[model samples]
Target: MRKRIALLAACGLLAIGTAAVPANAAEPVFPLVGPSALELPLPVDGSGAREQRLSITLDHPATGAPFAGLFTVDLRKVAGVATVRDHASDSSHQCTEKDGELLCAYKGLPVSLELDVAAAKGAAKGATGEITVTGKVPGATVTPLTTKVSVGGPDLVMREMKLKKDLRPGESQPMPLVFANEGTQAAKGVVLELGTTRGMELVETYDNCRTRTAGDLTTVLCSVEGDFVPGAAYELAGDSPLHIKATAHAYDDVLRYGIYPAGDEPKAAASSGKARAGRKLGVSPAKSAPAAPGLRASDLNPGDNRREFAFHTENTADFTTSPVSLKGKAGDTLSTAFVFENKGPAWIHAANPADSLARTVVVVPEGAKVTGKPQECLAVDADGTKRAEQLGAPRYECALGNRVSENEKVVYPFDLLIEKVVEDAKGSVTVGDWGTSAPRPHAFDPNAGDNTAAVVINAKGGTGTGPSPSPSTSGSPSPTPSASVSASASASPTAKASTAGTGTTAQGGNLASTGSTVGPIAVGAAALVAAGGALYVAVRRRGVRG
Candidate 1:
C-alpha cells in the first residue's frame, strides 16, 4: 500500500511540472535539504552580543509516505554558539557539546530544524567560519554539505551638506554641516576640515579647530572629541555655529576623517624554511606577518568624498536710450530711427528665446500716422487695442532680442505719414519700463533718466521755416519752393531708409540711424505747380466774361 501511494504521489508531481502555474495549482515540492549560509555580525567595539538564526529545511519530493532520516549539524570550525533550541513540535532532536563544538541531530521527514545562535564574548570581527550538515535517509542518497559564515563589521558613511539660504558677499551666514555613522560600530576620533576659496572668510570658532590662512584661502581643521555612535549624527553647528562670508564670489570645500572597521588581517603569511646549518635550503623566510586587528580611517572615494558650494554678490545693469529727431513736410512720409543701449556690469540673459529681459516701447507722435514698423514691433494702443481705431495715439512695443550685452545697442525705425502741420510732434521712447514684469523687467536699472528719450518731429513748410506762399487763384504762377524744402536735405538718405531695416542691429556696436527722406515728394511737388497754373488761367477767363 505504501509503494502504491508513492507511485500515485509521483504521478501527481508529474502533472504539476516546473513551470509557474496559476495560484490555484498546488506548488511542486522537492526533496532538497541544506544548512543556509550565515552572515553574523561582530561589533567593532566588541561589546554587544550578536545573534544569528540557523535553520535546515528538508522538503519531501513525494507527499504520501513519511521518510525517516537522521539530520545533523556539525559545528566544528565556528566557536561562538551560546545556546541552541529546536523549533519543531516533534521532540526528536537533541544538541550535544563535543570537543569545543556543537553537534545537533534530528530525526524526521519533511522537517525544518530551526535554532537560535548567540555569539560568545570576544568573538573576532571580520573572521570566517563554516558549518557542515549530514543527512542519512532510508531510501535516498544524503549528500554532505559545507557552508561559509562571514562576520560583518561596521560601515562608515558621511552625509552631504545642503545650502539653507543664498550666500551673499559681506554678509556672514551659518552653513550647516553634518556627518553620520551608518555602520554597526561607532566611529572614533572623528575629524572634519572645511576649506574656502579666495574670497571666503571663516568667522566662528569651534572645539579642536585650528584655523590657518595660506595666501587668499583659509582652512579650518576640527577634531570631534567624542565617539560617533552607530546611526547617529555629528553636527558641526551643535557646538559652535559655522559662519562664513565671501568677500566676493567664492566656493567652500569640506572633507571628513573618521575610523571604521577594516576587514580582518590575512590568516596566514607565505613562507619557506630558512637555510639549515650545513645544507642549503635555497628558500627565504616569510616576508611579513599579518596586521593587528583594529579600525581603519576613511579613504578618498572619488565621487563620494568631497563637496563644494558657492555664493556671489549683487549685479547691476544700466540701459540708456539716445535722442531721436526728424523733419518732414505735412504730406511727406517720415522714417525716424531710435537707439537703445546697455551699459552693464552684467549681461541681461533671456531664460528662453521667447522670454526677454528688456523691452523698448515707442510712443507714436500725434499728427503722424504710423504706416510701417519692423516685424518685431507689435502696434497697440495704451488700452491694449491693436491698430487702434479711435487713433488718438498708438504705441509699438518692440522686443530687443536676447542677451543685450554690455555696450550693445538696439535700433528701432518707424515709418509715419505726416497728415497735418504740427511743430515739434514730440513722442517718447523708453527701455526697461516694466520692472520685473512680463516680457522683461529690468530689475537693476539704477538710472531712470537715460532709459527714456524724446522724439522731436519738426514739421517742414510750417510758420517757423518761412512765410506761407500765396495761393494761386487766377493765371498767376505759384512761387517755387526752396531747394532745401525736402526733409532729406537736412539728413542724407541711406539704403536703410528706402528699405525696412532688419530687426537686429549690425555687427558693430554702432547703431545706424535711418535718415528722414521722402522719395516721391520731389515728383509730387512739380505736378502740383503745373496743375495750379492751369486752374488759375481758366478762373481768369470766367471772371472776364462775367
Candidate 2:
C-alpha cells in the first residue's frame, strides 16, 4: 500500500497522521503519540542534570502488532542542544545506536520507545534545539517527528497548601489556587484544572472553565488567555478564589489542583459539566513572593505540575440493595430489576471520575437463563472466571460508576428466560470490590451487615429477605455528587509525586488519593478502579468488570 505521513502542530503539540490513500489498499490511519516540544531544565541549580527520557508511542497502547517495536528510529539532533545516549537492553532484544540513528530491534511488541536524551552541558535558558525522530514501521511508513528541545519553557508550579484540620460538614472555605511561572520564558496562557472528591464540591463555576463530573468527584478545567510572566507569582483573584464546601454527609475527601502552559494540560473525558455563565476565573499577583530574590530555572520540570490533599469529615453513608421479587414460569421470559440506594449521612463518589464507586454483583438464581443483561456487565462463574459465552453465566458483575449520591437510587434491569422454576430459589444481590467475589463492607459505612440483599425467584411460601428499605427517602443526610449517576466510561489518571517547593498531589494512584494519613476509603478501593474495573464504563472499568 502506498503510504504518506503528516506532522501537524497544534496547542504546542504534534498531531502525527497521513494524507489520503486509495480506499482499496489503504489501512486505517494511526497517529504517533509523543511530545512535540521537550523542555530541559535551566542550569540554575549549579549541578548538571541533563538526562531526560523521550517516549515515542505508536497509534495507541491496545494495538499489539508483532513488529511494532522492531522498527528503526532515524535520530537527527541540532548538535549543540542534546545528544542521544546508547540504550541497548537485553530483556526484549538489543537496541543499538549507529550512525546518528537507533535500530530499535525487539523480540516483544513494545508500544513506546524510551530513549535517553542528554542535554548539552552549559545549556542556558532559552537555548533552542531539535531532536527529529523518523520511525520506519514494517508495513506503513511513519512520519518523522521533530521535537523542539529548548533549555527552558514556562513551568507553572502550584503552592503547597496547608489544609484546615477538623473540617466540619456543610462548611465552605476559600482555597487560593496559587501558581507561578518559574522558567525563562513567559507562558502565553494558562490552564488551571482541579479535581475534588465526592464529599467536596467546587462551590463556584466559571465561564472559562469546563467541569466534568462523575460519582463523588468533579473536575474543572479553566482556560485563561494572557501571558503569565516568569518570576511573577499568581493566585486566583481574592474575589474569585476557588471555594470548596463539605456536604452535610461529608466523609473523607480530596482536592487536586494543577496549572499547565496554555493548552498543555491533560485532556478530560466525555460527559462533563458545561461552562457556566459566571465570571471567568482570573489571577492576581500573590501578596507573598518566593524566597529567592530573582527568577532562575529551578521549576522547569513537568513532573511537578499537579498536587492533591486528602481531607476528613466525621460522617457516614449506609449503602443497601432493595429486596427484589422476580418470577417466571418454565417457558416464560421476565424482565425485572433491583434497586440500589445510598442511605446517607454521607454521599459516596468515586473522587477520581474514572474509579468505580461500587459494583452491583448479581448471582442469578438456578434454573434461570440470562437472555439480556445490563450494559457493561460481565458473564463469569461463581469464582469470577470468564465464561465462554457472554451470557448464561452463574454470576454477573455490573459496575456502578464512581458517583452515588446520598439518597440516590439506581435500578439494574435484567431479562431472563426461565428454563425451570424453583420455589423460592434465592440468588444474591451484593456489592463487591474488584478483588473479591464475597460481599464486604464499604470503608465509610457504619452498618456493615445489610449490603447484600436476597433476590427471591418464584417464592411459593413467601420469602422475607434483605433489609427493608429505609423508612423515608426524604431529607437524608448526604455528601456532594448528583442524584442519579449512571455508569459511564470512567478512567483513573496517574498521579505524580510532589517534589520540594511545589504543590499538587498524584493522580489515579493507590494509597495516595484516599488521604494523607486518614480517610474513609482505603487504597484498595482506588486499586479496584485503576487496576481492576459499564453500560455507563470507561476502558479502565471495561477491563476490570469484564
Candidate 3:
C-alpha cells in the first residue's frame, strides 16, 4: 500500500519549526513532519548503544492557525536492528505499543511525541530500519511521515573555545571552528555557518564562504567538503584564523556557529552577498590524534553540532525620548510622532536575529481619535490585548526589530482627529522591552529618567504634556494605563525598521553542535533558554549582562 503521509523534505530534517503549507482557507492540509533520519551511537569500546529519538511534530498551513482536537498516530514499523521504546512513565503522554506497532492518542496537536531508539544488541554498525507514521484526524488529510534509523553513522561534534578576554570596542578576536567525526563511517563533507551578533562583523572574506545580512546580523556560510575519517577531528583552515570584531558600538553579544553535513543546509532563497575573495576554506585533521573526518551520511547523533559563545564589551547606551506638547482646539486634526534616539557608547540589540528588539508606545490625548498610523503598529485596549478594530484605539504598539544602531532615531507617526480638544489632555510614550506594559530594568541603560515621554494637546494651566523637544525629567507621565511600544525609521502613516531576526532549534541545548566547551564567556552563571536550541544567558562582572 502506498504510504499517504507527508515526509518533511529530507534536508535539514528539522535538526526544527512548524513548516507552513500553502492551502485554501476552507481546505487546509496538515503536513506531518519529523527528522529525516536517526543515528544510534554504538560506542566503539563496547559502552553500549547511545539512544536517539523518533520524534514527530506537525506543521500548519499558511494561515498560522493550528488545528485543535484529538488525533491518533500509528507507528506501523518495518523491523530492523534498532529497538524502539515508549515512555510510559511520562504522565502526560498517552501512547501504547502492542504487536510491534505504536499508537498514540494525543490531544490537540502532537507538540512532539518521542520514542527512544538505540542499536539492538548484536546489531552491526550501519544496520538500518524504518518507521512509518500516519495520522488520523476526521476530515483532515495529513500525509504520513516516516523516519529511518541506522545503528551507526558519522557524528559531527563542535569544540567550544575561549574567546579573547577583555574585548574592547573595535577589537577583534579569533574563533577557531573545530569539530570531529565520531562515528562508524566517514563523513564526505561539512557545512560551516557562523552568525556574529549585532555590533560585530566577520573579518574574513573568502571565496568558499558568503556573507548574508539578517536584520542587524551578519551570517557567513562556508562549504568545506572533504572526506572526514571517523575518530579524527578537523578544523577549517581559512586563509587566516576566523576572527569576529566587536565594533565601536558593541556591548553584549554572542557568536553562534554550527556544523552540518554539506548537503543538509536548509534551502534558502539564493541570497546575494556571496563575496568571493579567491580564498577557499580548507579542512585538515586536527593536529590532535583525531583526523578531520565526515555529516548526515545521517549523524548517528545530531545533537552535538552547534555552539554559541556570549561576550560583552565594556560599554553602555543612553536612549532618551521627550514629551511633545501641542496647542490644538476642538475639531482640529493634529499630526505628530513619538520618537527616541540612541546616544551611545554602545548600540542595543537582541542577542540573535529572531529575538525581539526594543519597542515604542504611543497613546493619544483625550478626545482625539487616531486616524492615521503605521501598518506595523498594533491597536490594543487599555490592558494591551489586541483590539479587533485597528484604528481609533486608546493605544498602539510597534516592533523595533532586534537591533538599534548607534545614534539611530526611531519614530512612530500618528494623525489625531480632535473630537473636542480638552484642556491639557495628556498621553504617554514609553520605550522598552518587546511591547509590554511593564519592562524589566534595562541593565545597560544609564539614563532611566528619559525612558518615558509625554504627548499632550490643548494646554491650560500647564497641563497639556509630551510637548517640548527635550527629555523629560519631571518623572513618569503615565497618562496611558496600557503600555505597549516599538519603532523604526520615518515612513508614511508610520515608521519602518529592519525585519525581525530569525531563530534556530525549537528546544534543548543538546541539538547539533561540535562538543567545544565555551571559553571566558562561560565564567558567569549560565542560564539556558531553549526557545532556540542552546541559546544561553550569562551575567558577567563590570555590570554587563547577556
- Give the candidate order by descending TM-score: 3, 2, 1
lDDT-better candidate, 1 vs 2: 2
lDDT of 3 at 307: 84
lDDT of each model, Cα atoms only?
0.46, 0.58, 0.59
What are the C-alpha RMSDs, in order, of all predicted structures? Answer: 24.7, 14.7, 15.7
Better of 1 and 2 by TM-score: 2
**Which digits, one per residue and each the tens of the lDDT, describe model 1 over residues 474-502?**
22222234321222232222212111111
User: Tens digit of lDDT per residue, candidate 2, span 158-232?
Assistant: 887766745788888878567877776777777788888777887887888888876446888888777677788
Please give me the total number of clashing residue pairs in predicted model 2: 29
Query: If ranked by lDDT, best first, what sequence of candidates would result?
Result: 3, 2, 1
Candidate 3 accuracy as TM-score: 0.55
Instruction: Show model 3 residue runs off by greater than 4 Å.
Output: 1-39, 43-80, 84-117, 126-150, 266-275, 288-296, 322-325, 330-333, 343-345, 350-407, 413-546
How far does residue 331 in candidate 3 sit from its true spot (Å)? 4.8
Look at candidate 3 and tell me the lDDT of residue 12: 43
Error of 2 at 14 (Å): 3.3
lDDT of 3: 0.59
